[model samples]
Target: MHRMPTLSLPMYDINHQATLGLTSALTTLLQQRGVPAEVSWPQDLLPHWRDDQLLLSQTCGYPLVELLPDVQLVGTFLSSAQGCDGQRYRSWLVVRSADENLTLSDFRGRRAVCNSNDSHSGFNSLRYVIAPLAQDGKFFSATRFSGSHRQSLAALRAGEADIAAIDCITWALLRRNFPQELAGLEIIGETPLCAALPLITSAKTGAATLEKLRSALSELTSEKRYQDLLAESLISGFNVSDRAFYDEVREWKDRAAALGVTAL
Candidate 1:
């Protein structure tokens, strides 16, 4: 038997039964493809523990681009129920509770919650949308990190937060799976769509290996069962995305710095 490489996965995806399912199934798929890799869905930022054994790591909007600079981005998807292609990517500003009929102007002196400080859709993209209206400390009286997107959504549900910059992809998935959870909330507005999260690979891997992996992913939806699973997770399809696409996100970050919104 030949040895296989391991890939650490995010627990939120698995716990939510989002895209990927049980570890056994994932491992089997990898082994069948000749890349015996292990998948771990831990709850921490993957870049912190990234090692040579990691073939790929999953992360959200900005953190993925910031944290893993060397890996090759593989898959990209829109949050607002769009497919893997960036064509339909969108953003939504969600109020923490139904009673908080806060307008976009009401962001002032209120707490703002994001998935992470480095998230593009969660922070950078939102920054671009609010740049015109936000004043230094008035727009957001305070900011908090709910760690994961789910936590941020939960914070809104529990009234622990005032507003959250939610990715349209996750929001759509929640709306499909748990409509009751999002019963009273309203989308005040939408931000310009940013590039979707790309599934990435390290440069250390061989191009042939990468090609084979890409082919496998391309065909993931061809199988009926897999297609249904992805539909359940709100994934439209997998598509190829290059690193240059993320440069715009970097440029946005640079512009934010120029405006003293360096936190983005």
Candidate 2:
């Protein structure tokens, strides 16, 4: 006998309203197939990602390639967010809108912030954008992790950091949920478009259950009934994928490293 674990939509859970809307639809879809599902928010996703009971969740590309090799890749979402196209997404290098006249090079020796080193959109994409401009393995005067993308935006707003790289999907969500946070920020540049977040489930899931999970995602995007819900979540479509589809993300990291730079 097999039991399905809770469904966790943790990555872009920035807005509770949106998260709830999505959770409701997904739960209904899964339940229709006799997959008992409920939303659970794990404070630390690393351990939860590896748990044998993990049913389905979205994770960034960095972790998919570097960690959690055993986690099954479910699929990738085709986000309708501003910086997304097809199955690819990019980052916006943000600074105060007051710096409109300043270019990327103008911020030399200034501070930068990101969500985490493990985050693909926040740190990896950001590092790839500036690795070419680095000197002696250094780019910013100081670099720090602000914990989350919204915090990084707030840091720029509060004058704590000169610039930060934020995922464009997050940028759109903040615009809808908390527009004031971005009131005075502008995108100085856009990073290279790489793979979007990979949806994953536990490797311990039976093949029959795995297909159900994948089918739920596939129908979520293709069906007209969920179109409105998808629009609300900034998801335009969904693409079937495996771990090999995320090789581009790791390539970005390798390209950055080849520049003789480490961190940003």
Best by lDDT: 2
lDDT of 2 by residue, 99-154 (tens): 97788888889999999999999999888878888887778899989989999998
For each candidate, how many residue pairs have backbone atoms clashing (under 3 Å)? 11, 0
Q: Which regions of candidate 2 fall more than 4 Å away from where they truly are?
A: 1-4
Give the candidate number with the greatest TM-score: 2
Q: What lDDT score goes with residue 238 in model 1?
A: 64
The digit string of per-residue lDDT tens for model 1 on 52-107 reads 45565555556656777666666664332742234336568888455456677767
Model 1 lowest lDDT segment of ten: 78-87
Reference-based TM-score, model 1: 0.84
- Model 2 superposed RMSD (Cα): 1.6
Reference-based TM-score of each model: 0.84, 0.96
